[model samples]
Target chain A: MSSQSFNRLTPYLFMAPAAIIMAIALFYPLLYMVFGSFRSWDPSQSLSETEFVGLANYIKLLGDEAFRESVSVTLTFAGTVVVAEMFIGVGLALMLDRNIRGMSLLRTLFILPMMIAPVVVGLVWRFMYHPTDGIFNRWLTQLGLPRVDWLGDHALMSVIIADIWQWTPFIFILSLAALQSLPRSALEAARIDGATGWQQIIHIKLPLMAPVLIVTCLLRLIDAFKVLEVILVMTEGGPGLSTEILALRISRTAQEFRELGEAAAMSNYLLLLLMVLTLGMFTFTRWQEARAQQLNKVKQEEG
Target chain B: MPKIRLDGLVKRYGAVEVLHNIDLTMEENEFTVLVGPSGCGKSTTLRMLAGLDIVSEGEIYMDDRPISRLEPKDRDLAMVFQDYALYPHMNVARNMSFALRLQKRPKEEIDLKVREVAKILGLTEYLNRKPGELSGGQRQRVAMGRALTRDAGTFLFDEPLSNLDAKLRGQMRAELALMRQRVQKNMVYVTHDQVEAMTLADRIVVMHGGYIQQQGTPEELFKRPVNKFVAGFLGSPPMNFMDVTLEETGEKFFARGDGFRIALPGRLADRARRVGQSELTMGIRPSDLNFDAAAPDSEAMDLRVSISEYIGAQSVLICKCGEATVTVEVKSETPIALGETLRFAVRPEGIQLFDKKTEDAL
Candidate 1:
């Protein structure tokens, strides 16, 4: 090969190892799952022994009330947790975005929950929601209030509160970073222009922080859809699939029900939802960048 | 218009004090310019008067009323910042009308005010564009327009034109002077540029190291600077200083230094004699030194020209006299050559003297 041709091929040669690894580590399992999603497979038999059952799993899930219930539960879990976490997290960030003694230490404490292992968080919250021996119920009993079934009748809501407790910190740290990086002089000018504290947040802070907050909320939403360990440990899809998100349902479909095809189909549905959110984030960022570039071009032309 | 007064105002950040007891009184409808070098507490004093900073020791009074405790909004004043602190998200009209909108003025009234200010600033065409869409000069105009729409009694500018290029700064300075004539309000502008202070000030307050060095009209500060620092600060190319001693040369008092001896201006001889200090430093402005080839030996100093900087109509020549380097501003057409010795007659009226030990004017 000529030197020019070799130079052109150098980049591809460098990328070849990563591409091959991706094919085996990522695309291979993805293709296997997609192919297996169309076959009626059993744990007792090899993949070659499985019979072709094209569209059977999807058709079965269409009218299955349990599958429909799990979908609704997943939507409720992701939606409620995301919306509530965003509000409370952003509100806390705005409130605490000031210099005080020990403020840095306090901010670190606020983000502690997001660093804990999800399984450990699940176990911790599960013990905290215990009926008779839990700290909350024990304290409530001492306060002369009656004991309530926190993880029984309110299993879905209980799991949601736990997830929020463990995940709001993620949104809190991101929102705080966005708030701190905002142009300070604009906010100071707002104050001099007679903006009240609340007015400054509404008019200056929130609008400038909207782009970052949107991306953070979308990222959290994508994560929220596939949440499993916390709810699985707390209720294990109990109380008639009240807290059973799609990820937990897929796990049970393969391990307990021995329906690998249905599990693969459910996983694909979750992946599709997350893909939409990721695409939305990418589009928003691209639009922002394009607008900034256009503004720069106009300024240069004017000059 | 309200008369503003800073009565014994001071500022301190923890243990370090940035502004000493500053007492200044601005008359109604007077334009006061504070000129000083960087870190000279001029901006801090302005911020204090604007209610953006807390007065550490004293209060600010307006028309004999203590208004230091009020919020900036309650103080009923307007300010233009150095960086043209326009809101990036808002267009020109919105940015200019923000204060009016905050006051909940009538929609028609806010529109009228914004339109009027924009028209005056020649920014009507760009009112719908964001600050990022405008040039730096246009952004500065919007900042000015924002301040003008307030209809306040007092206006404070903190180095409002310092961010622009040299040519644009000169243009804006002229525009600001024209605007000052039209607006009959108490104005206090801060700048470190001596030219800005000289051309635009009704009265100039020169500050140094948290202390007020001198405060007077431009001519007073230029002709009779109270000390050596003010003399060097207010002039371009700065005033030249040379170590000299006062000699009782028979009948005439002469400031005799190495390579030169000049008779003191007749009017200052008695004053210099009364000072009774032999050790003194002589000051001469660059503009006051004129080319005098036939000057008598006693009244002229021989300066060796080292470099000539051509700046349009005039050129500045850096020359050495004895051990001191002096800058001389001359017309570019003046016949001058490098490495040649020249004689410049010192104009007596432009000579100043300072005590060697204290640096105070004699």
Candidate 2:
């Protein structure tokens, strides 16, 4: 080969290892799962022995009451946890954005929850939700109040609360970063223009932080949808499938029900939902960059 | 219009004091300019007057009413910032009308006021555009429009034209001077440029190191600077200082220094004789030195021209008299050659004497 052809081939040679690993580790499983989702495959049978029954697994899930319940539970958990975390987390960031003494220590402590392993957080929260021996119930009993079942009757709510506690620091840190980066002069201008404290937040701070807040909320939503370890440790799809999200349902379908095709179909559904969210985040950043480019072009023309 | 007064206004950040007690009074509808180098506490005083910074001591009054404790909005003043802090998200009209909207003014009144101010600033065509979409000069116009819509009793400008290029700065300066005639308000402007202070101010306050060095009309400050600092700071080429000793020669007094001795004006001879200082510093402006080959050796200094900076119309020659360097400005058309020694006569009245140790005008 010519030296010019060799030079052009060097970049592709470097990318070959990553591409081969991606095909084997990522695309192989994805392709196998997607292709198997349209077949009638049993755990006892090899993949070559199974017959391809097009769309049968998906159609069966459409009518299955248990699968529908899992879908609804996953939606409720993801939606509720994301919204609740966003509000509480951004509010906490706003309240803590000042320069009081010991504020750096307090900020570090606030973000410590996000740094913990998900399994550890779940185990810690599970102990806290224990009916009789937990700190919360013990305090309730000492205060002359009836002990409420945390992980039994209100299982989904308990999982949602645990998710919020574990992930709110994610939103808080991002929101604080956005708030700190806002233009100081613009806020000063707003203050001199007669904006009160609340008015400044509403008119200046929130509007300026909107782009970061949107991306943060979407990232939290994506993480919330894939949550499994915390819910698995806390409830294990307990008390009649009340807190069984799609991840739990997929695991249970393949392990307990011995239906690999149905489990594969469920995973594809979750993937589709998350793809839309990821696309939304990418589009937002691209649009922001394009707008900035347009502004730069206009400025250049003026100059 | 109300007269503004700063009675012993001081600023301190924690234990570090930035401004000493500043006492200044501005008459109604007067244009008071604060001119100083960076970190001279001029901006601190202006921010204190705007209520952006708390006055650590003393009080500010407007028409005999104490206003130091009031909020910036309550002070009823408008300000144009150096960076032109227009809201990026809002259109020009909305940015200009923000204060009126906060006050809950009638929609028609707010619209009328925004349009009127926009028209005055030549921003009517671009009122619908956001600040991000406009050029810097356009954004600056929007900032001016926002301040103009307020109709406040006082206007404060913190070096508003310093962000522009030289041509734009000069253009905006003329527009500012034109606006000053139409807007009858008490204006306090802060800038490091003495040209802006001289051309725009009804009264100029020259400050240095947290102290007001001198305050007066442009001509008064230019002709009679209180000390050496003001003399060197206010001019383009700056006043030159040379070491000289006071010598009594017959009926006249001469400031004799390195290569030359020039007689002092008759009025200042007795004051020079009484001081009896063997060493003193003499100040002369570049424009005061004239090329006069016919002048007597006693009154003229033989200067060897080293470099001549030709700046159209006039050329400033960098010349030396023995070890002392002096500058002379003459018509550019004059025949001049580098490395040629020429005798330049110094006018007696142009000589300013200062104490060598104190640097105070004598």
Candidate 3:
């Protein structure tokens, strides 16, 4: 090749290793799953022995009531946890954003839950929710209140409580970072303009932090949708699918039911859902940028 | 219009006391400027009056009603910040109308007020634009527009023009002067720039080391500063300080130092003799020194010229008078060569003397 062509190819040559690793580590497995999703195969069978089913597994999942129930459970789980986390986290951030002694230590302690292993968090919470021996129930019994079922009749709530306990700190730290980075003078201006504390939060703090909160929400939602290990360790998708999320069910389908093709198809569905959510986040940020640019254009035109 | 008074106000952050007892009074609709160098507590005083900072001691009275404990909103004052803190999320009109909307004012009234203020500030064309989309000068106007729309009894400006570039600051200064005439409300502005204070203030308060050095009309502060700090602070090219000895020769009083000795005016001589301090600090404004080759030795001081900074009409000459340094503002076209020793006559009335130990006016 000519020197000019060689120079043009240099950037691509540098990217080749990363691109090849991605193809092997990421794209190849994804392609295998997509292709396997079209087939009906047992785990024991070789790939050549599997039969091409042509959307049979996907169609089966659509009609299956159990799969449909898990799908709805996943959506409700992701939506509720994200909404709850956003409110509590952002609220806590607004409260803790100040200069008191030991504030840095307190802030560090606040985000410690998110730093722990999810499985360990699940196990710790499982022990805490034990009907007779748990601290919560023991306190209830001592207080003359009836002992509440945590992992039994309220299995879904128990697992969700565990999930929120582990994840709320994730949202809190991000929201706090967002809150702290906001323009201080604008908030001061809000005060001078007669905005009370509550008004300052609503009008100045939240609106300024919307972009970060949106991105944070989408990130937590994406993670919540694919959650398995914590729910697996805490409730084990017990009490007949009450807390059986799509990811747990997908694991059961492949491992217990011996339906590898069906599991792949289910995983594809989860990926598709998360893809839509990420695209939504991307589009929202792009819209904000475009609006800002348009306003800038107006000013530039006048100049 | 209500008169404002800061009575024995003090501010202390933990063990470090920043402002001493500050007592000040402004007549109704008066424009008061607090001017000083950084860390002089001028901005702190303004913030206290704005209700942004809690008063560490004493009371701030408005029309004889103490307002120290009130929230900023309840204090009924508008402020223009140095950074021009317009809300980045809101458009110019929304930012300007924030105070009115917070009060649950009628939408029509808020819109009308915002529009009127925007037009006055030349921000009408940019009302729908976000602050992030506008240039620095435009954002400054939005901040001013926000304060104007409040129509509060008092306006507090904390170095509002300092953020702008030199050319824009000058233009905004002129606009502020024009606005001051039309707006009848009381205003307390703070800045480190003496020029802004001189031009904008109806009354200028010079501060140093957390104490009020002097407060008076700009002309009064310029002509008769009470101490070395005030005399040195309130001018473009600051006043030159010369360490001179007050010696009585026959019946005449002469301030003799380094290069030359010049006769003191009769009024200053009488005052200097009463306190009876031999060592004195003499102050001469840069503009007071005039080039005169044939001037008498007792009336003029000779300066060895070094550097001439040609700034338009006046060239500020950095010259040495004996061992003490001095700056002389003279016409740029003056035929004076570098390294040449020249005589510049000191006007009798322009001489100001202070006690060397106390730095107080003699």
Candidate 4:
């Protein structure tokens, strides 16, 4: 090869190793699942012995009532947890964005929950929600209130509370970062313009932080859709699939029911939902960039 | 309009105090410019007056009412920041009318006020454009328009034109002067540029090292500075200082230095005699030095011209006298040659003498 051609091929040569590793580690399993999703496969038989079912697994799962119930449960959990976390997280950020003694220590302590392992968080919460020995029920009994079922009848609510407890700090730290990076002089200008404290937040702080908050919300929504280990360890999707999200359902389909093809189909459905959310995030950032470019064009024309 | 007075105002951050016992009074409808170098606490003084910062030891009074404890909104003022801190999300009209909207004013009234200010600022055509779409000069106009629409009793500008380019800063400075004439409100502006302070101030306050060096009319501060820092800070080319000793020659006083001796005028000589200091520092402005060859030796200094900076109608010649460098400003038509000795006569009345140790004017 000529020197020019070798120079052109140098970057690709350097990238070849990582590319091959990604193909084997990531794409290989993805392609295997897509291939098995179209077959009637079983764990007992090798892949060569399975028969090509041609949409049979997908059609059956679509008609299954248990699968539909789990989809609704997943949607409800994602929606409630994201909305509740956004409000509580941003509220905490705004409240703690001032200068006081011990504020740095308090802020460090606020994000500790997000650093804990998900399974450990689940177990800790599971113990906390015990009916008789739990601190919540014990306090309720002491306050003359009835001891209520936590993981039994209200299993979905209990798991949602646990998920929010572990994830709200993620939103809190991000929102605080967005808050601290805002132009400080703008706030001082607002104060001189006669904006009260609440008025400053409603008009100045929130509007200026809109872009960061929107991207953070979309990212958290995508992550919330795939939550599994916390709920699995806390309630194990018990009491008739009340808290059984799609990830847990897919695992049960493959492991307990011995239906590998149906499990792959279920996993494909979850991937589709997450893909849409990721595309939404990508489009939002692209729109922001386009608007900025248009603004620069206007400025250049004026100049 | 009400007169504003800062009575012994002090500011401290932790154990470090940034402003020391500042006492100043601004009359009704006066334009006061606090001019200083960076970190001289001019901005801190303005922020304290605007109620953006707390007064550590003293109080602020407006028309005999103590207002140091009041919030910025209750103080009834507006400020223009250095970076033109307009709301990025709001367009020109909305940004200007934000204060009125916060007060829940009528829609028509807010619209009328915003349109009036926009027309004054020549921003009518771009009223719907956001701050991001505008250029630097346009953003500066929007910031000014935002303050104008509030119709507040006092206006504070904290280096509002410093962010613009040199040409744009001059244009905005002239516009600010025009606006000052049209509006009769009390205005307090802070800047580090001496030219802005000289041209736009009804009263100029010079500060250095967290202390007020001098405060007076522009001409008074220029011609009669109380100290050495004020003398050097208030001019474009800056006043030149030469170490000189006061010599007595039969009822006539002469400032004798290394290479030149200048006769003092009667008024200055009397002031120098009253101070009775032997070792003194002599000051002369660049504009006061005239290129004269036939002038007497005692009245002129022989300087070798080194570099000539031609700036349009006038030229500033950098020359060497003995070991000290002196700058002389003359007409561009003056015939001058480089590396040649020339005589530049000093104006007797322009001579200022300061005590060498205290740096205070005699």
Candidate 5:
């Protein structure tokens, strides 16, 4: 090749390794799962031995009671955890976003749960949520209250509580960073404009922070859908199909029932849901950007 | 409607004090400007007036009623910030109406007030535009309109025009001066630009090094600065200082430097005799020097022109009088060239004499 063509190909040459690695490590499994979703397969059968069952696995899941229950359960779990975590985390961030001695130490302590491994967080919460010997029940008994069945009757709530405990700090730190980075003079001007503390937050701080908060919420929503470890450790899809979210359901379908094709179909459904959510976030941000650009263009013409 | 007063006001951050024993009073319906260079405590003093900073030692009084402990809003004042702190999310109308909304004013009244102020600021066309969508000058006007819409008795400006480009700043400054005439509210403005102080201030308080160096009308500060700092600070291109020694040539007092000597005017000549200071610094503004080759040596300083800066209409010639550099503003049409020696007669009334030891006016 000529030197000019060689120069143009240099960037692609550098990217070739990462592209190959991604195809092997990521896209290969994805393609394999997608292909397997159209066949009747078992753990003992090879791909050659498996019979063609195009759309059967997906058709079966459409009417499956257990799969429907898991979808509902997954939505509820993800929605509740995200909503509760957002409220508590943003509240804590707003309350603590000020200069005070020991604030840095307090912030470090607050984000400690996020730093711990998710499995460790799961195990710790599982132990704490034990029926009678758990610290929570023990404390309730000491406080003259009846001990509640944490992981038995209230398995979904207990699982959600554990997940929220591990992840709220993620939102808290991001929200705090967003809050601290806001234009301080705007807040001061609000004060001069006769804004009370509450007024300042409502009128200036929250509106300015909405963009960051929306992105944070979307990120958390994505992670919440793929959440498997903490729930698996805490409830193991528990006491019924109550807390059997899509991830746990897929794992159980493949590992326990040995329905590899059905499990692949279920995994695709979950992936489809997450993809929609990711696309929704993208659309929302793009719309906002387009509106901003339009406004600027109009203003420029006027100027 | 209230007269504002700062009695021995002080500001301290931790163990270090910034403003010490500041005493000032702004009369009712007067425009008081606090002008100084950076780190000169002009902004700090204004912040204290706006209740944005703690009064470390003294109390602020309005209408003889103490307002040191009051919130900024309770002081019945509005402020324009240096950065034009408009709400990014709110449109110009909403930003201007924020204070009125907080007051729970009727919707009709709020709309009318916003419209009135917008019309005044020529922002009627841009009321629905958010700050981010507006240009810098528009955003600054929205900030000013936000303050104006409040109709507060006292309006405080903290370097509000400093963030604008030079041309825009001049435009806004003239607008502010026009506003000053239309509205008689007590206005306290802080700026490092002496031109702003001179043009807009009814009374100017010149500060330096966290202290009030001098306070008076703009002309009073310009014509009769109490100290060297004020004299050097209040003029454009600054006053030229040449160190000279006082020598008595018979009955006339002559200021004699390395390579030039000029007889002192009557006022300074009599004052120099009383000061009895052998060493002095003579200050003469570039505007006060006129080219007059035929003038007597005693009344003129012969300078060798080095570089002439052409600025249209008039040009400033950088000239040398021995070791000291002197600037003389001459008409652009004046026949002057580099490498030529010229005599510029000093205006008798324009010579400012200062004591070398104290830097105080003689």
Candidate 6:
């Protein structure tokens, strides 16, 4: 090969090892799961012994009531945690944006929940929600309020609260960063333009932070959908599928029911949902970049 | 328009004081320009006037009302920032009408006011375009239009034209001057560019090291600068300073220095004598020095031309006068060449003297 061609091939040669490893470690299983979804495969059976049952597993999942309930539960958990976290996170960020003596320390504390191990967070929250011995119920009893069932009838609510506790700080730090990076002069201009503190936040602060906030929200939403460990440790999808999110349901379908093909199909459904959300975020950022580039082109042309 | 006053104003950030006691009063509808170098407390004073910065030790009064404690909105003022701090998300029309809209004014009134200001600024065609889409000059106009739409009693401009390119700055400056004529408001502008201060201000306040050096009309400050700093700062190709001994020979007073000696005019000599200082600094503007080889020795200085900077119509000749470098402005057509000694006649009326010890005007 010529020198230029050799130089071009050098990068590919360096990338070949990682590419092969990815194909073996990532794509092999993905393709295997997709292939197995079309067959009546069991964990004990070899791939060659499985019988081809094209569309059967997908059709079964489509008609399954438990599957539909799990999908709805997943949606509710992701939606509730994301929306609640966004509001509370953005509110806290705005309140803490100013300078105080211990503001940096306070911000570090605010992000501590996200830094902790997810399983540990779940275990701690589980203990906190322990029906009678939990701190929450103990405080309620002391306050003359009725001791409520935290992980029983309100299992979904309890798991959601736990997830929110672990994830709200993720949104908080991102929102705080966005708030701090906003153009200071614009806020000062708003002040001189007679905008009240609330007005400045509404007109200047929030609008400027929209792009970062949108990306942060979408990222959190994607993560929330794939959340398994926290809920698994906290409620274990307890009280008859009340908090059986799709991830937990998929694991149960493969492990407890031993329906490997059905579990693969369920995983594909989750993957499809996450793929759409990822595409949405990708398009949003691309659109913003394109608009900015076009604006620069226009500015240059005028100049 | 109400008269504005900053009485004994001071600013401190923790233990470090950036602005000392500043007292200034602007008459109704007067254009006041605070001209200074960087970090000279000019912008700080303007921010204080706009209530953007707190008055650390003094009060700002408008028409006898102490407005230091009130919010910027209650102070009834509009400000144009250096970066043309137009809302990036808002279009020209929205940016211009934001103040009025915040006040919840009638929609028709806001629209009418925005349209009027846009037409004045020549931003009517770009009203729907966001700041990002517009060029820097257009963004500057949008900032100006934002302030104009407020119709506030006072307008504070903090280096509004500094962000634009050279040509755009000149064009915007002319537009600003024209706008000033059309709009009768208390306008306080801050700039480090002396040309802008000279052209736009009814009263120019020259500041240095957190202190006001001098404040007067543009011509007054130019013709009679109170000290060495103001004299050197206000003019282009700035005033040349030469150390000279004030020698009295018989009836006339002469300023004798190395490589040149010039007779002092009667008025300047009397002032120098009254100050009772023999060692003095003489100031002569480049514009006051004419290229005249035939001029008498007592009225002319022999300057050795070192370099010539051609800047259209006129060229500035950098010359050597003893150990000091002096700049002389002359017509480009003038026959001058490097390495040649030339005599430049000093205008008698243009001579200024400062006490060498105090650096204050004599």
Clashes of each: 0, 0, 0, 0, 0, 0
Candidate 3, DockQ score (0 to 1): 0.62
Q: What is the C-alpha lDDT of each candidate?
A: 0.91, 0.90, 0.92, 0.93, 0.92, 0.93
* Ranking of all candidate structures by their DockQ, best first: 6, 4, 3, 1, 2, 5
Per-prediction TM-score to the true structure, in the order listed: 0.97, 0.96, 0.96, 0.98, 0.97, 0.98
Q: What does candidate 2 score on TM?
A: 0.96
TM-score of candidate 3 to 2 decimals: 0.96
Clashing pairs in 6: none
Best by DockQ: 6
| Model 4 residue B217 distance off true place after TM-score fit, in angstroms | 0.7
Q: Is the docking of candidate 2 incorrect, acceptable, medium or high quality?
A: medium
Write one digit per residue (lDDT tens) for candidate 1, span A1-303: 899999999999999999999999999999889888898988887878898999998889878899899999999999999999999999999989998989999999999998998889889988999999998899999999998788989888889999899989888999999999998767767777888888889888998899999999999999999898888888899887888889989999999999998888888888888899999999999999999998998889876
As a TM-score, model 1 comes out at 0.97
* lDDT score of residue B83 within candidate 3: 95
Going through the candidates in order, their DockQ values are 0.61, 0.60, 0.62, 0.81, 0.58, 0.81
Question: In model 4, which residue pairs have backbone atoms overlapping below 3 Å?
Answer: none
Residue A129 miss distance in model 2 (angstroms): 1.5
Candidate 2, residues B1-362: lDDT per residue as tens digits?
Answer: 89999999889988998899899999999999999999999999999998888999999999999999988878889889999988888899999998889889999999999998888889999999888888878888888888889888998899999999999899889989999999989999999999999999999999999999999999888888888889888877888899998888789888898899888887767777777776888899988889989999777888999999999999999998889889999889978899999988888778888888988787
Output candidate 2 Cα RMSD.
1.9
Quality of candidate 3's docking, in CAPRI categories?
A: medium
Native contacts kept (model 2): 0.44
Q: Provide the global lDDT of candidate 2 against the true structure.
A: 0.90
Q: Residue A172 deviation, candidate 2, in Å?
A: 1.7
DockQ of 4: 0.81
List, residue by residue over B107-196, the lDDT tens digit for candidate 6: 999999999889888898999999989888888889999999999999999999988889999999999999999999999999999999
Stretch of 10 with least lDDT, candidate 3 chain A: A294-303
